[model samples]
Target: MSEFADQYLCAFRQTPAETELHQAAKRYVSEAEAYDRTVCTGPISKDGILPATPRELALVNRNAHALLTRIADAHSHLFSRGELLREISRVDRLGAPA
Candidate 1:
């Protein structure tokens, strides 16, 4: 697994949340993995770019947005801005953008 995946799994293990946030994170990870597999298997264009199909793009975007919103909603009220930034930094160290 990649560092990001390792970090995500670790986060899930370490943090406690309501069902919705947990599920959202799980879905985000699932969609990300799917995107990774798609990129690995997707066809390259004539110009050499690996363009995603509209459906694939939509799925990834939707899941990513949902995950971010869920994370924010789950933590925003509980954590101060500095605390949130620290958490975000930790997650960013996973080497993936949110």
Candidate 2:
């Protein structure tokens, strides 16, 4: 989450906009999206191993919960910005908050 915030801030800093910690907010939402895309996708079958089963699904859910908790703690009000708001609209259009 902190890294997300840092990256968002960096992006804003690239421009001349004075984001004023709003970058942190954008970062949080971006992190959520990234996690959803990268980690939430079920694992692929490996070698002769099968894809993730129900047990693996449960574990993935648990780990995702923990990771989100940690991210929220680290980024507090990371979604308190216009950029994040726009992202919310974009994501909501796609479906859930993600």
Candidate 3:
């Protein structure tokens, strides 16, 4: 296993179970670790996000984007209106998201 995956897989151990973004984080971490495992276990990437193929990269992007959406939905209350708007625009989620 790459040390890259091991690092994040070990970092969020104390997140409360099934709450807010923790839910998506669970799935994201699982998928990331699985992807990391598919590669030859060798020198870990410095960026910790080296995908072996285009499809695998897409999967990672999708999961990460969804996780961020869940994070925004769960904590929108914590953000000021301008902050929320900026984030939404930054992620290109301004044009009718559900």
Q: Write the per-residue lDDT of candidate 3 for residues 1-98, one digit (tens) a residue.
A: 69988776664454332243343344445554565556534445643547667776677677656655655576665543344435444333322222
Clash number for each model: 0, 1, 0
Candidate 2 Cα errors over 4 Å, as ranges: 1-51, 80-98
1-98 per-residue lDDT for model 2 (tens digits): 59878776654233323242344334544555454445444543321122245765565466546654554455445433344455444543554321
Candidate 3, superposed: residue stretches over 4 Å from native: 1-43, 80-98
Worst 10 residues of 3 by lDDT: 89-98
lDDT of 2: 0.46
Q: Could you give candidate 1's per-residue lDDT for residues 30-78 as a string of tens digits?
A: 5555564555435654322233677666765666566656666666655
Give the TM-scores of the predictions, in the order they appear.
0.37, 0.34, 0.40
Lowest summed lDDT window (length 10), candidate 1: 11-20
Report lDDT (CA) for all predictions: 0.51, 0.46, 0.50
Predicted model with the maximum TM-score: 3
In the order shown, the candidates' Cα RMSDs to the true structure are 12.3, 13.2, 16.2
